[model samples]
Target: MLTHLALKDFAVVQSAELAFGPGLTVISGETGAGKSLLVDALGLLSGLRADSGVVRHGASRAELVAEFSLADAQPATDWLRENALDEDGDDGRHCQVRRVVRADGGSRTWINGRPVTVGQLAELASHLVEIHGQHEHQALLSRPSQLALLDAYARNDAERRAVAEAAGRWSDLLAERERLTAQGDVSDRIGWLEHQHAELERETLDADSLAQLSIDHRRSAHAAGLLEACERAFAVMDGDEGPSITRALRQARDTLQRVAEHEPRLNEVDTMLDNAAIQLDEAAVLLDRIRGDLDLDPQALEALEQRMGRLHELARKHRVTPEQLAAKRDEIATELEALRGADERLQGLDADIAAATRAWQAAAEVLGATRRDAARRLSSDTSALIAELGMGGGAFDVVLEVLETVRPDPQGAERVEFMVAANPGQPPRPLRKVASGGELSRISLAIEVAALGLDAVPTMVFDEVDSGIGGAVADIVGQKLRALGERRQVLCVTHLPQVAAQGHAHYRVSKSASDGVTQSEVQALGAKQRQDELARMLGGVEMTREARAAARRLLSDAG
Candidate 1:
C-alpha cells in the first residue's frame, strides 16, 4: 500500500504532501477547486507522461515522490531487490519512487534515490499501484480486453498460458510443414542437390592447396627468365675468361703468403683473401643448383595455368571466393541429406502438430467452460447491483462467441464482449453502443465491484465513481465502494456528500488566489473539519445547521 505521496510544483498544486493508509480515502471539493489534481499527481507517480504543462508557473520543473512500505508487499520488495534498485533502505522493505520533469519536457526517474529508466519505474509501479483513470472503463470497448478481463475473473491463468504455448508450437510445425509441401516434390529437390554436389566434388578446393597452386603458377610462368638471370650472374662471377674474381683472389693470397715471412700484418691480409675465395665458390655452387631446379617445360606451365583458370571459372559461376567453394559443397551435401529425409520429418511434424492441437483444444475447452461459469455469475451479480445505483431492472450479459480458426491461435478460440440492456423489455446490445457516458461509468463501477475477487491490484483508484447517480442511490454507491475498500486500498475523488461521508479518511481541496495567481491545496480533514466539509457538500455553499446534523448522522452511519 502507498504510505506517502509528495508533489512539488505540479499543476495548480504548488506543493503538497499527504500520507495514506489502507482504506477508502476520499477527496472532495467545490467546483474548480482542483479535486482531480490530486488524482493526477498520483497518476504521475505511476509512470504517466509529464511535461511543462503540469509544472507550476515560474517553477523550473515538477517533482513527484511516492513511498511504499513492503511489509505486506513481498512481491514488490522481491522485484526491487532483484533489479538492484533497493540500495538506500537497509531492510529492503521500503521503496521510494521519484520522477522529475524539467521545463523542457524531459523527465528523469529514480528508485530508492538511484537513477533508473522510466521503463523500470513503470514496471515496478505495476506491483505497487493500479491507477484507474476515469476513462479506463472505456477499455471494455475492445474485444481483446474483454476476453482478458474474463480470463482474469475466471482465475484460469495457468491453463490459459498452457494453451497459448501449445498453440504456438502447433502453429510453428504447421508453418514448417507448409513450407516443405511448397517444395512440390522431394524427389526433384534431392535430384537437383545431388547433381550440384557431384559437380563440386570433381575439383579439390582446399585453402592451402589453392594458395600453393597460385605460387607454383607464378614461378612456372617466369621459369625461363629466372633460369637465364641466374646463369648470367653465375657466368660473370665464375667464368673461364680472363681475370675472374676467384683467380685474382688466389693470386693475391699467394703473393701475401710470400710476404708473410717479412711482415706479420701481411699474414692477416692473406687469411682474409682466402676466406673471400671460399665464399665465392660456395655461392657459385648454389647458383648451379637453382638453375637445375627451374621447370622450363612449356607443357607443365600450360597445364598449371589451365588448372588455375578452371578454379577461377568455377568461383565466378558459384559466386563465391575460390576458398569458399569447399564450404559450399558441404552445404549442398547437407541439403541433399535433408531432402532425402524430408518425408520422414514431415511425418514427425504431423504427429507433433496433431498432439499439440489436441492439447490446445482440451485446454481451450476447459478455459471456455470456466469463463462461461464465471461470466454468468459476474453478469448476474453486476446486473443486480446496478439496479440499486439508479438503473432499475437493468440487465448485463457476457457475450462469448466461439470461433472456427483455420489455425490454432494464442488466445484460445473465442471472442468476448460485454452487453447490456437498460430497460426491462429492451434487447441487449454491446455496452459501448447502448450505454451512455454516465451509464458506462456506473456499469464499470458495478463490474469493478463484482470482480473484486479477481483483482490482484493492491490499490484501486476511482475518479468520480458516483458520476451520475444521486439521493438514495448515491448512498448505495458509497456503501459498495466502502465495502471494496475493506479489501484493498481504495481512493476516490468525488463531489457527492454521501460518498465523502463514507470514507475512512477525507481530504478537501480549496483553491486560493494571490496576485492573480491561483493554486490548489489539499487538507486531510479531521473529524470536525470533515463534518463541515460534508455539510458544505450536502447543502451547497451555505452549510446550514440541519446540513451539519445530517452530515454527522451520515458519518455516524458510515462508521
Candidate 2:
C-alpha cells in the first residue's frame, strides 16, 4: 500500500505532502483545481515519464517520493530478492520509490535510497501498483497483456513451469540436431579420414629414423666433396715426405732432452711438440674412419625427401603448419568417431523431440482445460457484476480460441477475448468494438474488481473511473471500489459526490496564488468540510440547501 506521497515543485503542486491510508481514499475538488496534478506526481513516483515543465517557476527541479509498505507483498519481496534489490532490515518490511526531475529535462530514480535505472524502477513499480484511467485503459487492449492477466488470475504456476521446461528441452534438442547435421555425410567423411590415417600410418617416422635419415641425406647430398676433404686431411696428417710431423717431433724431443740439463724451458717446448704429434696421428685415424663410413645411399635419401614432401603436402591441405599436423590428425580422428555415431545420435534426438512434444501436448491440454473452466466462471461472475453496475441486460463472455500449432510458451495456446452483448437476443461481439468509452470503463472496472480478487498487487488506483454516469451507477461503482478496498488499498480521483461520500478519507485539491505564483494544495477534509465539498460538487460554485441535504443523504447511504 502507498503510505505517503511527497511532492515538491511538481506542476501547480509547489510543495505538498499527503499521507495515504488503507481503504477507498478519494481526491475530490472542483475542475481546474489541480486534482490531476496529484495523480501526475504519483505517476512520476510510479516510474512514469517526467516532464521538466512540471517544475515550479522559481524552482530548479521537481521531486516526488512514494513510500509503500511491503509487509503483505510477498510476491514483490520475492521479485526484489530475485533482482538483488531486496532491502536489509529486521525491523519491518517497507519499500520506498522516489523520482526527481530537474528543470533541465533530466531525471533520476531511486528505490530504497539506492540509485536505480528508470527501467528497473518501472519493473519494480509495475508489481506494486496499477493505475487505471481513460488513457491507461489501452493496456487492456493488448492481447499479450490480456493473456498475462488471465494467467495471473488463474495462478497456473504448475502449468506455466511445465511449458517453460518443455521449451528449454526442445531448444536444446534442436540445437544439438543442427550441430550434428552440419557435419555433412558421415560415410564419405569416415572414408576420407580412414585413407588419411592409412597414409600417415604407412610412413611412421620415429625420432631415431628421422635423425638417421637426416645424417644419410646430408652425406649423400655432399658425397664427392666430403670424400675429397677427408683424403686431403688424412694425407696432411700421416702421408710420407719425412714421416711427417711425428718423426720430426720425436727427433726434436730427443735433442731437447739432452739440452734440458742446461735449460729446463727446452724440456717444456719438447713436451708440447710431442703432444701435437700425437694429436695429429689421432686426427689421421678419425679421418680414415669417416672416409670409410662415407658411402652414399641414394635410395635412403630419396625416401627421406618423399616423406618430408608428403608431410608438407598434408600441412598445406589442412591449412596448418607442419608442427600442427599431429593435432590436426587427432581432431579429424575425433570428428570421424562422432560421424560414425551420427545415426545413433540422430535417433536419440528424434526420441527427445517426441518426448518433448508429448510433454508439451499434455501440459497444453491441462492448461486449456483449466482456462476453459476459469473462463466460464469468470464470464458468469463478470456478467453478474455488469448487471449490478446498471447494465442489467448486458451479457459478458470470455471466449477462448485454441491455436493449431502448440508451440511451448509460458501461457499455452489459448487466445482469450472478452465478448459482450449490451441487450438480450443480440449476438455478442468484441468488447472493444461493442462498448462505448463509459461502458468500457464500467466493464473494465468489473473485470478489474473480479481479477483483483486474484492479483497480488497491494494498491489500485482509478482515475475517474466513475465518469460519464451518475446516481445509482456512480454509487454502485463506489460500492465496488469500497469492497475492493477490503482486500487492497484503493485510491480514486472522482467528481461524483456519491463516490466521494463513500471514501474512508477525503482530500480536496484547491489552487491558491501567493507572490504572483500559482500552486495547488491538498488537504484532508473533515466531516462538515466534506459535506460542503460534496454539496459544491452537486450545485457548482454555490452550495444550496437542497444540495446539502442530498449530499448528507448520499453520505448516510454510503455509510
Candidate 3:
C-alpha cells in the first residue's frame, strides 16, 4: 500500500508530506483548491511524464516521492526482483519511488534511492498501484480494454497460455514455409551454380601444381635469351683456345709451388689460384646443364595463359578476388543443396502448420466457452451492483462475439463489448455510446468492486467518481467506495459531504495566498473538524445552524 507521499516545489504545493493508511481516504474541497495537484504529484512519482510548469515560481526543481510498504505485495516484490531493483540486505517489505523534475524540463527517477530509468519506474509502479478516474473511464471505453477486463475477471490463464503457444507455433511454421518456398523457387539458380562447378572441376587445379606451372611458364617464356647468356658465360670461363684463363691460372700455380721453400707467401698465392681454376671448371659444367634444360614450349605457355584467363573471368563473374573463389563456390554448393531438398522441408512445414491451426482452434473454443460462463456471472453481479448504486432498472451485460476464423493471438478470437441499458424498456447498447458520465462512473465502480480480487495492485484512486449525481445516489456511491476500501486502499477525491463523511480518513484542501502568491494545503480532519468541513460544504462560505445539524446527522449515519 502507498504509505506516504512527500512533495516539494510541485505546482502550488511548495512542500507537503502526507501519510496514508488502509481503507477509504477522502480528499474534499472547493474547486481550484489544488486537490488535483496532489493527484498529479502522485502520478509523477508513479512515472507519469513531468512538466516544467509544475515547478514552483522560485524553485529550480520539483521533487515528488512515494513510499510503499510491500509486506503484502508479493507480486510487486517478485517484479522488483526480476528487474534487479531489489534492495540489498534490507527487508523486502518496503519500496520507495522518487521523481525529480528540473525547471528546465529535465527529469530523473529513483527507486529506493538508487537511480532508475523512467521506463523501469513505470514498470515497477504498475504492479503497486492502480489510478482509475475519469481518464481511466475513458480508457475502458476502448474495445481492447473491454476484452482484457473480461479475460482478467474470467481468470482464463491456462486457456490464454494454450492459445499463445499455438499462435507461436503457427507463426514459426509459416515463417519456415515461406523460407522453403523461396529456396525451391530458385531452380533457375541451380544451372548457374552447376556451370561454375564444372568450370572449376575441368581445371583439376591444386596449389602445388599451380606453383610449378607458373615457374615453368616464366622460365620457358625467356628460354632463348637465357640459353644465349649461359653459352657466353661458359665460353668466357672455359674456352678451348690456348687453355683460356683456367690453363693460365694452373701454370702460374705450378711455378709458385716450386718457389714455396724460398717464400711462404708465394705458396699461399699459388693455392688460391688453383682453387679459382677449379671453381671456373665447375661453373662451365653447370652452365652446360642449364643450357641443355632450357626448352621454349609454346603449348605449355598457351595452356597456362588459358588457365589464368579462366581464373580471372570467374573472379569477375562472382565479384570476388581469385583467392576467395573457393569459399564462394562452397557457399553456392550449400545453397543448391537446400534448394534441392526444399520440397520435403516445405511438406513438413505444411503438416506442422495444420497441427498448429487445430491446436489454436481448440484453445480458442475453450477460452470462448469460459468467457461465456464468466460473462453470465459478471452480468448478474454487475446488475445487482448497479441497482445498489441507485440505478434502478439498469441492465449490464457482457457481449462476446467470436470471429469466423481462429486468429493467431493469445487472447483468443472473442471480441468483448460491455453493453448496458440505462433505463427500463430501453435496449442495451455499447456502454460508451449509451452511458452518461455519471452512469459510466457508477458502472465502472460496479465492475471494479466485482473484479477487486482479480486486480493485483494494492491501492486504487478514484477521482471525480461522484460527478453528476447527488442525494440518495451520492450516498450509494459513498457506500460503494467505502466497500471497495475494505479490499483495497481507496483514495477518492469527492465533493459530496456524504461521501466525505463515509471516509475512514478525511482531508480538506484549502487555498490561501500571501504576498501575491497562492498555495494549497491539506489537513487531515478529526471528527469535529470533519463535521465542520461537512457543514462548510453544505453551506458555502457560511455554515448555518441547520447545515451544521444536517452535517452532524450525516456523520452519525455514515458511522
Candidate 4:
C-alpha cells in the first residue's frame, strides 16, 4: 500500500507531505480547489511523464517521492528481487520511488535511491496502484481494454497463452512463405551466383598471396631502371675505365705499408685501407649478381597486368574492395544454395503452417468460450451497479464479434465492446456514445467495482467517481467504495457530502492565493470539523440548520 507521498513545487501544491493508511480515505474540496491534484501527484508514482509545465511558477524543477510497504505485495517484491532492485541486507518489505523533472524538459527517476528506467518504475507501480481518472473513460470505450478485462476476469491465462503461441507460430510460417515468394526468378539469381562462386573457388586470392603479387608487380615495373643503375655502379667499382674505388684503396694500402715498418701509426692506417678495399670488392660482386637476375620480360609483365585488372573489374562490379570480393562471393553462394532447396522448404512450411493453424483454432475455441461467458457476467454485474447509481432502467451489454480475418489473433477469435442504453426503450449503443460525462463516471465506477474482482492491485483511486450523482444514489456509491476499502486501500476525491461522510478518514483540501502565488493544502479533519465541512458541502455557500442535521444523519448512517 502507498504509505507516504511528498511533493515539492508540483503544480500549485508548493510543498506537501501526506501519510496514508488502509481503508477509505476521502478527500473533499470545492471545484478548482485542486482536489484532483492529489491524484496527479500519485499518478507520477506510476511513471507518468512530467515537465517544467507541471512545476509551480518560478520553480526550477518538481520533485515527488512515494513509499510503499510490501508486506503483502509479493508480486511487486518478486519483481524487485528479480531485477536486483531490492536494498542490501534488508527484508524486501519496503520500496521507495522518486521522480524529478527539470525545467529544461529533462527527468530522472529512482527506485530505492538506485537510478531506474521509467519503464521499470511503471511496471512496479502497476501492482501498487490502479488509478481511474475522470477522463480515462477512453479505456472503458476501447475494445482492447474490454477484451483484456474479460480475460482477466475469466482467469484463463493458460488458455490465452496457448492461443497466442499458436498464432505466433502460424504467423512465422506465413512470413517465411512471403519472403521466398518475393525473391522471384530464383534460377537466374542462382546461375549468377554459381558463376561468381566458380571464379573465386578456382583462384588463390588470399591476402598474403595478394601482397606478394603487389611487391612482384612493382619490382617488374621498375626492372629496367634498376638494372641500369646497378650496371653503372659495377663499372665504377670494378674500374672499367679510370681507377676504380677498389683499385684506389689498394694503391693507398700499398703506399702506407711501405712506411709501416718505420711507424706503428702508419700500420694502423694501412690496416684501415685494406678493409675498405675488401668492402668495395664485395659490393662489386653483389652488383654483378643483381644485374644478372634483373629481367623486363614484356609477356610476364602483361600477364601480371591482366590478372590485377581482372580483380579490380570484379571488385567494381560488386561495389566492394578487391579483398572483400571473395567474402561477398561466398555469401551469395550460401543464399543460392538455400534457393536450390526452396521447393522442399516451401512444402515443409506449408505443412507446418497448416498444423499451427489447427492448433490455434483449437485453443481459440476453448479460450473464446471462457471470454464470452465472462463478458456476459461482467456486463450484467456492471449494468446492475449503474441502475443503483441513479441511472434507473439503464442496460449494459458486452458485444463479442468475430474479427474480419479468418486467421487467429493473440486476443482470441473475437473483439469485445461495451454497449449501453441510458434509458428504457432506447437502442443500445457504444457506451461512450450513449452516456454523457456524468453518466460515464457512474458507469465507470460500476465497471471498476465489478473488475476489482480480477484486479490484484493493492490500491484503487477514484477521482470524483461520484460526479453528477447525489442524494440516495451518492450514499450508495459511498457505501460501495467503503465496502471495497475493506478488501484493500481506497482513496477517493469527492465533492458530495454523502461520499465524504462515508470516509473512514476525512481530509479537506482548500486553495488559497497569497501575494499572487496560489497554493493548495489538505488537512485531516476531526469529527466536528468533518461535520462542518459536510454541512458546507450539503448546503453550498450557506449551511442552514437542516443541512447540519442532514450531515449528522449522514455520519450516523454511515457509521
Candidate 5:
C-alpha cells in the first residue's frame, strides 16, 4: 500500500506532502485546483515518461517520491530481493520509489536509494499499485487486457503457465521439423563430410605424436653436421695420435702421487687429476655413441618434409591450425552421423510435434473451462452492479469466442469480449462500440467491483472514475468504492459532494496565486474542514446553511 507521497516543483504543485492509509481516501477540489496532480505524480513514480512540461514554471526539475509498506506485498518484496534492490535495515518490509524529471526532458529513477532503469521501476510498481485513470475505460476495450482480467479473477496461474509452456514446446518442435524438411536431401553434404573425416583420420594428429614427429624431422635434417661435430670432439678428447687429454692427465697424476710423500697438498692435486681423467674418458665414449646414431639419409629427411607440407596444406584448407586437425575430424564425423540419420530424425520430430499439439490442446481446454466458469460469474455480478449504479435495465455479458484452429495458442483456445446493452429491449453489442465515455466508466467500475479486486496489486487509484454520474448514482459509486476499500486501498479523485462525503479520509486541493505565480497545495482535512469542503462542493463558491446541514446528514449516514 502507498503510505506517503511527496512532490516538489511538479506542475502547479510546489513542495507538497501527503500521507495515506488504507480504505477509501478522496481528493476533491474546485475546478483547476490541480486535484489530479497527485495521480500524475504516482504515474511518474510508476515509470511513466516525463517531459519538461510537467515541471513547475521556472523550476529546474520536478521530483516525485512515493513510499510503500511491503507488509502485504509479498510479490513486491520478492521482486526487490530478486533484483537486489531491497534495503537492509527494515527486512525489506518498506519500499521507496523516487523519480526526478529535469527541465531538459531527462529523467532518473531510484528504488531504495539505488539508481534503476525506468523499465525496472515499472516492473516493481506493477505489484505495488494499479491506477485507473478517468479514461482507463479504453483499456477495457483491449482484448488481451480483458482476457487477463478474466484469468486474474479465476486465479489460475498454474493452469495458464502450463498452457503457455505446452504451446511453446509445440511451436519449437514444428519449427525444427520444418527446417529439416526444407533441407531436402543432404546426401551430397554428407558425402563431402565423410571424405573430409577420412582424409584427416589418415594422419597421426594427436599432440604427442605430432611433437615427436617434429623432433625427429629436425634431428634428421641436421644429421650430417651432428656426425662431423661428434667425430671431431671424440678425437680431440681421447685420440692417441699426439698429446691427448687422457694421456696428459695420466702423466700429471703419476708426477703428483710421487710428490705427495713430501707434501700432503700434492696428494689433493693427485686425486683431482685422477677424477678429471675418468670424466674425460666417459665423455669420449658418449661422443662415439652419438657419432654412431647420426644418419645422413636424404630419403628420410625428404619424407619428413613432405609430411609437414601436407599438414600445413590441410590446416589452410580447414581454416585452422595444424594442431586442431584432430578436433576438426571429430566435429565432421559427428555432423556426418546426424545427416546420415536425418530421415529418421524427421520422422521422430513428426511424432513429437503431434504429441506436443495434443498436450497443448489439453492444457488449453482445462484453462478455457476455468475461464468459462469465471466469466459467467463475473458477467452475472457485473450485470447486477450495473443496474445498481443507475443503469436500471442495463445488461452485461461475457462472450467467449472459441477458436476453431488446430495450431497451439498460448492464450488458450478462446478469446473473451465484454458485451453490454445500456437500455431495455436493446440487443447487446460490444462494450467498446455501444458504451459512451460515462457509461464506460460506470461499467468499468462495475466490473472491478464485481471482480472484488482479485488482482494482487495492493493499491488501486481511481482518478475521476465517477465523472459522468450524479445524485443517487454518485452516492452509490462512492459506496461501492468504499466497499472496495475494505479489500484494497483505493484513492479517488472527484468533484462530486456525495462521493467526497463517502471517504474514510478527505483531502482538498486548493490553488493559490501570488505575484502571478500559481501553486497547488493538498491538505488532509479534519472533521470540521471536511464538512466545510463538502459543503463548498455542494453549494459552489460559497457554503450555504442548507449545504452545511446536508453535509452533516451525509456524514451521519455514512457513519
Candidate 6:
C-alpha cells in the first residue's frame, strides 16, 4: 500500500506532499487546477520516461518520491530481498522509490536509497502499483491482452507451460527434418570423404615417426664427408704409421717422468701429457663408431624425401600443418561415418516428428479446454457488470476463434477476441470497434472489477476513468471503486462530485498565480473542508445552498 508521495518543482506544482492509507483516496479540483499532477508524479516514480517540459520554469530539476508499506505486498518484498535492496527497518516491511528528472531530460532512479536502472525500477514497481490511465482502456482492444487476461483468470500456468514446451519440441524436430531434406543426396560427398580417409590412413603421421625420418635423411645427406673425416682422424691419432698424436704424447710423458725426481714442476707437465694421450684414444673410438653407423645409400635418402613430400601435400590439401595431420585424419573418418548413416537417421526423424506433433496436440487440447471454461465465466461476469455500469441491456462476450494450421502454436489452438453489444438485441462486435469513449471506459472498469483479485498488485490508480459519466451512473461507478478499494489501495482523480464523495480520504488541488508564476497546491481535507470542496465541485464557482445540502446528503449516504 502507498504510504506517502512528495513532489518538488514538477510541472505546475512547486511543492506538495500527500499521506495515504488503506481504502479509497480521491483527488478533485476545479478545471485547470492540476488534479492529475499527483497521478503524474506517481507515474514518474513508477519508472515512466521523463521530459524537460515537466520541470517548473525556473527549476533545474524535478524530484518525485513515493513510499509503500510491504506488510501486504509479499511479491514486492520478495523482489527487494532477492535483489539485495531490502533494509532492516520494520522487519523489511518498508520500501521507498525516488526519481529525479533534470531539466535536460535525463533522469535517475533509486530504490531503498540505492541507485538502480530504470528497467530494475520498473520490474519492482510492477508488484507495488498498477496505474490505469484514462486512455488505457484501449489496452482491452488488444487480442493478446485479452488472451492473457483469460489465462490469468483461469490460473492456467501449468497448462500453458506444457503447451509451450510441447510446441518447442515439435518445432525442433521439424527443423531437424527440414535440415536433412535440404541436404538432398550425400552419396557424392560420402564417396569423396572415403577416398580422402584412405589416402590419410596410408601415411605415418605421428610425431615420433616424423622426427626419426628427419634424422635419417640428414645422416644420409652428409655420409661421404663424415666417413672421410673419421678415417683421417683415426689414422693420425691412434694409427701405427709415421708420427702420430698418441705416440708423441706418450714419449713426452715418459721423458717428463724421468726428470720428476730432479724438478717437482716437471711432474705437473708429465701428468698433463698423460691426460692428453687418454683423450685422443677416446675421440678415435667415437669417430670409428659414427663412421660405421652412417648409411650412404642414395635409395634410402630418396624414400625419406618422398615420404616428406607426401606429408606436405596432404597437409596443404586439408588446410593444416604436418603436426595436425593425425587429428585431421580422425575428423574426416568421423564425418564419413556420419554421412554413410544419413539416410537411416533421416528415416528415424519422420517418426520423431510425428510423435512430437501428437504430444503438442494433446497439450494444446487441454489448454484450449481450460481457456473455453474461463472465457465463458469471464464473459458472463463482465456482461453483468456492463449492465450495472449504466449500460443496461448491453452484452459482453469472449470469442475463441479456432485457428486453421497444421503446425503447433504456443498460444494454444485458438485466437481470443472480446466482443460486445452496447445495446439490447444488437449483434455483438469486436470491443475495439465500440464507438463511444465513455462505453469503453465503463467496459474496461467492468472487466477490471470482475477480475479484481486476479492481479497481485497491491495498489491500483484510476485517473479520471469516470469521465463522460455523471448522475446515478457515476454514483454506481464510485461505489464500485470504493468496493475495489476494500481489497486494494485505490487512488482516483476525478471531477465528478458523486465519485469524490465516496472516498474515505479526500484531497483538493488548487492553483494560484504569485508574481506571474503559477503554482499548484494539494491539501488533505477534513469533514467540513471536504464538504465545501464537494459543494464547489457540485455548484461550480458559486456556492449555492442547494449544492451544499446535496453534498451533505451524498456524504451522509456514502457513510
lDDT per model vs. reference:
0.83, 0.79, 0.82, 0.84, 0.88, 0.87
Q: Model 4: how far is 295 from its true place, Å?
A: 40
Best-fitting candidate, measured by TM-score? 5
- What is the C-alpha local distance difference test score of candidate 5? 0.88
Work out candidate 2's RMSD over C-alphas: 8.8
Candidate 4 TM-score over all chains jointly? 0.65
Residues 1-559, model 2: lDDT tens digits: 8899899888888788888898989999877888867767767776777777888887999989988888867777777788767778733378888888999989999888889999888778767776766554344555665666677777787887787787778778878988988876778778999888666556544556656766767787787799988877666555443355666677888888887999878878977888898887887788888899887777766876877788778879878766666667778778778888898999899898888878877887788877787788788888999887877899888889887774565467678888888667889988767546567667777877777646666777778777778878888999998888887888888999988998999999998888888778899899999999999999988889999999999889888
Please give the ranking of all candidate structures by lDDT, highest first, separated by commas: 5, 6, 4, 1, 3, 2
Model 5 pairs in collision: none
lDDT tens readout by residue for model 4, 192-217: 88988887676557888778878878
Error of 1 at 292 (Å): 5.3
TM values, all candidates: 0.68, 0.69, 0.67, 0.65, 0.83, 0.72
Quote the positional error of residue 292 for candidate 4 in Å: 44
Q: Name the regions of candidate 1 deviating beyond 4 angstroms.
A: 1-23, 31-137, 185-193, 228-293, 339-353, 380-384, 387-395, 421-427, 434-439, 453-463, 467-476, 483-489, 509-528, 544-559
Evaluate model 3: give its TM-score.
Answer: 0.67
lDDT of 1 by residue, 266-299 (tens): 9888878888898999988988898888978999
Candidate 5 colliding pairs, count: 0
Across residues 346-463, which tens digit of lDDT does each residue of candidate 3 receive? 8888888888999898888898898999889889999988887777899999999877764477678878999998778989999878546667777878878877646667887777
Residue-level error in angstroms, candidate 4, position 45: 4.2
* Candidate numbers, best TM-score first, in rank order: 5, 6, 2, 1, 3, 4
> Which pairs clash inside model 2?
none
Candidate 4 colliding pairs = none
| Clashing pairs in model 6, backbone N/Cα/C closer than 3 A | none
**Which prediction has more favorable lDDT, 3 or 6?**
6
Q: Regarding TM-score, does 4 or 5 come out ahead?
A: 5
Q: On TM-score, who's better, 2 or 4?
A: 2
